[model samples]
Target chain A: MPMSPEAQALLKAARKHPDRPSDEARTRMRRNVMRAVSAGAGAVGATTAGTAAAQTLFAKIAGGALVVAALGGVVVGGRALFSSSESSVDPKNAPASTSTSTTVVGTSRETSEALGSTSTAANLDPTSDRVVASSALRTTATPSASSVASSPRIATAPSKPAEANITSDAASAPAVESVDVLKEEAALLASAQSALGKGQAARALELTNEHETRFPKGALSFERRAVHAMALCALGRGTEGRREAQAIVDRAPGTPLAERVSAACP
Target chain B: MPTPNALRSVNAPSAAGGVIPVAATRGSRSTTPPKTFDDLYDDHVDLVWRALRRFGVSEPGLEDAVQEVFIVAFKKLDTFEGKSALSTWLYGIAAYVARNVRRSQRRRPETPTEDAGLHLTSASDSPEDEVGAAEALRVLHALLDELDDDKREVFVLAELEGLTAPEISTSLGVNVNTIYARLRAARAAFEQAVVRRRAKDARQLQKGGLPCR
Candidate 1:
């Protein structure tokens, strides 16, 4: 069944007018890919020097807010006490960033400031359904005075068994669903971090275990694993903690997160 | 077109450890050892971008879709065993990403249909040629939308992208015979569609509408 000449001509014309990504988009996406690649590409052990260069690049590109996001996860998790709702946080009522773009790198200081108060406020109402807004995730990522002010909720949340809260809704698109997933991921990791802070290493490990089950490839997985490693260290499981932390350090050397992970169980 | 290393089987990276070193190539031969990840991005970004469009990824989500593909590629860079052309491996990734994007789009309350093919960039210098090319592309997309996902993919890869049957096989992970079967069915469906469209245009021309190209 050969295509007629007319069909062939149509394909040729369509090919001539094929869609292309604009220069700005191409460059932005390239930078993003490079950043992510640099963080983990070196783990292959194929290029030691390349890995060294990647480490430097990772340090350069991983803005201050990224480190905060990691540290903030700990701060926010410490305060979040899980209550009733098993549903994933709704992206519809999520911060304005969720509707427009899936990822709003929350680099601005104002955004970071807002996150601290927002997470604290959300934690204040354990009775209300805990909504994981994009800002709340940012709060977990970027530590603020307000986030730190909120005392640990490890006493309240661990009394009940941890529930799966990241079940994504079919009504939401991936962009919105990602926001929801990130929120749930942040909440889980935040609670785990909080547990570690309150000397409840077992509770922290439990939350991280729940996180692993819900979001195996979650955006904040690195932080979750880091907290998991820390929890292991706190529980006197030094060998396991050291091994876990070493892999993360190997995968992304020089980054602040890896540096912190390396300190685990030492 | 089958890339020079079309038949190469990419060995999935070992559990222990081994790097998937990239190789750079010119027209039909290897020119240099595989360059940096940046080189891979430079060489194949357009292929991934257009392939995503052809695969029905909506324009609004296209950027994220492309990023997702590269991110996966970057994470799985060690999996590149050179078993297939780098482009083929990337295409396979694009196909998967596009499907997910579409699936998500469908779940939305209002699926956006603003993807007018007329906005596609035209290579023609003259206004008349540009209009003709745009109309042709519009017609092409209309026909393509009628086919099922499987046949549509085979048609796009075979007719528009010009990947040989074997190359499409490797990209799609479908058997060669199956690729041939879908391509044949898609061509026949496309030809019948073109004939119907031409007839409709002729009727419209008689009714005092613009001339059919």
Candidate 2:
């Protein structure tokens, strides 16, 4: 069958109808892409600063070689203590002894201050500390109860008193632990950024996944997710990446991070 | 229409390849490089909108579908090997996106016609003429709705979107003969539906003592 004259006329009329998207929509989309790129860059900056601050603090506290030597001493001391009579102590009685030790250690104000600083630093810089702690803890701590119960208390005892004294001494003390975490996060972000910049999207995606698993609550978590979305986009998984980006935006609204997510998702 | 220079060029022997003449050879020189997904949207937005209008997609729905098509194209651009013209490739994407949009709308029982309103022909004409044109377009849309999806897609691509049959075939991944057959069937179905609509409208106009023209 050939086309009827009326149907042809109708099609011609339909073709004559105009339908382009508005200027505003195009502008919004461009803005979204730009925002995602910016957020990834910003996360990298914050992480780098935090990493530098943490390394400086670590150097000042341990004095490099002495800190390494002290760590070796602690490991040897731990093994000896674990083999001693303390290994036979009942599990239920351990907390009481540990608390008592902490109290004794806290009696010295200087020791308390040092411990407080270290704890604060750990919390602030959890990214590096987390990696370091996981690896260090896995290697040094014997699974035996005596080693787990007594070692941390004894090791932290001297620093606890110093930390206690400095509680009020540095009211304005920057959160060193958070900074370290930020630095580690920044390094991950930088690696992802570099990979993405070079169009190695699959590598960026792999790095993002590793970062997320290792540092689920790391400061750069949201930013890492956004980068992951970008990697997805590059890989031609736009719909999936869009959904992930939307999730990031919903979870972290109003932050610079959210803006980045929306940008990528959009 | 062949110029003397064109004939001479065709006759001239190639320095490198003895059998093939330089000018007569296909794929010898690039026209425009194939458009990327981003390039497609940036270049043919107007064409996309026109295609959407033919499918009777509402303004907002059209916007969403257009964006979806381009986004999908962006993700899948690596697969596009410049085998077909960019416009043909894009039309296929737009058709797929529009069909999805229509299917989703069907599940909700909302009237796309009511939502779309009579605004398509309402802008440039007198109120009475706008109403007539809108009413005519509505009838045309009803007729289009009667055709099967494949036929309707071919019809829209060829008649409404003004693509050549070969272009439609390439975009649709069908043989040229299939496009021709679908276009013929689509046109016949559309014509029958339009005649029925016009007859019904005439009867109502006469019953109400209104002018039928």
Candidate 3:
């Protein structure tokens, strides 16, 4: 007997009934949404904070470099020395004349003989020695001395602080956990697909049911429904399968699962 | 339903008409001290969920797509001009996200059984015909499972969503003519499947077996 138009229309309407989100489900979604938003906001804040801290660090490094360069210039300038004529000609300032002069002459002659073979001995003269001592005093006066002493300390500072901050920040950051959830959902979907491939409709349905329980809002739900519809079709329960597939499509129009549902029913 | 020409007029690029008036500049009014990410989620939660449903995104993928859509929107919110409705913009994002999900699924080698089309239209019926209509729709859904994703989408958007061809073209980034052609093919395919299913069920009933319906 030919089916009445009324029957066909009735079936369509029943299939079209919008699946309402349960209150508990809605509450969970609201929470998930809140969690996702918080995670996003935290990510943004962390990125901004990281950039600002890096800029401050770079500025400090540049300032320290400039100070080091200035100290280097002072050291180079102190090395070149030119004596005045007065120091060489002042007799009163010179060693005692005669016997004292003879003793001085003997010592000077011996010093010159020793220095003739070594330019290093010539630089060890009192004037040069005085310059070297003054240069050393100036080097010790600047922050460069402390900076050099603290180089190892500075090298370790950033890493130690960063490790601590990262630990604390990770602890404080909001957990979205979407990726993990998605992975689990994807795995279930894969298993369901595998079961369907093996021609085990019941197993497929079980996997889909599990997925539905865990991820009610998952796109996989529609796909699972489609699989159920296929199973129904195989069992000669085409009407029920068709309805389930239609519900999936109606609930999630553009999803791959909807396509699956539609195909199975067709 | 609006005629195609009328829809065209409504969607025409005009200085005053095509633009949806917004209550405030889309991103500028965020004077509420930057919302904790949680606040943004709360604000658009329903919008995202509804849009995903409208787009026919399935349950398993729905949450991820929802999260992605909002994240993308938040990151790019600064670029949103106040000219268009925020919901529309978000819907556009949801559509894109849903499409991407489908594409990724396609790349994997899956069983042929995984292939199913989406049914867009509800068979018209009075309240008195509810039960039978429901059964028929279930059959219809099963039949839809044979269609490819592309055909399924075209049918859903054009018939169920009641979006005009041009609107679908814009949403899917396809040519308008392509939408029309796809719709025609999808409808034909669906009708043929339904007729075959009905015939099979009738045969089974005549053979002393219970009709699956």
TM-score of each predicted structure versus truth = 0.50, 0.43, 0.38
DockQ of candidate 2 (2 decimals) = 0.07
DockQ rank, highest first?
A: 1, 2, 3
* Cα lDDT of model 1 by residue, A1-266, tens digit: 66666677777787777767887667655643443333232211211222232222222222321232332332232122111111221222111111111122322222223223323423322322232221122111012112222221111111011111211221222232343344456656666766776689999899999999998756456566777887898899999999988866665455444666667668
**Candidate 1 regions off by >4 Å?**
A39-266, B1-31, B109-128, B206-208, B211-213
TM-score of chain A of 3: 0.31
Task: List fnat per candidate, in order.
Answer: 0.33, 0.15, 0.10
Candidate 3 per-residue lDDT over residues A153-224, each given as its tens digit = 001111122223223333333333432333244445545555665577777778777877886654233344
> Alpha-carbon error at A73 in model 3, in Å?
44
Off by over 4 Å in 3: A1-16, A44-266, B1-92, B99-140, B207-213
Using lDDT as the measure, the top candidate is: 1
lDDT over C-alpha atoms for residue B141 of model 1: 74
DockQ of each: 0.14, 0.07, 0.04
* lDDT tens digits by residue: candidate 1, B114-160: 33322212211222377777666666676676677788789888888
Clashes of 3: 51
Q: What are the chain A TM-scores for all the models, listed individually?
A: 0.40, 0.33, 0.31
Q: What is the C-alpha lDDT of each candidate?
A: 0.51, 0.43, 0.40
Worst 10 residues of 1 chain B by lDDT: B7-16
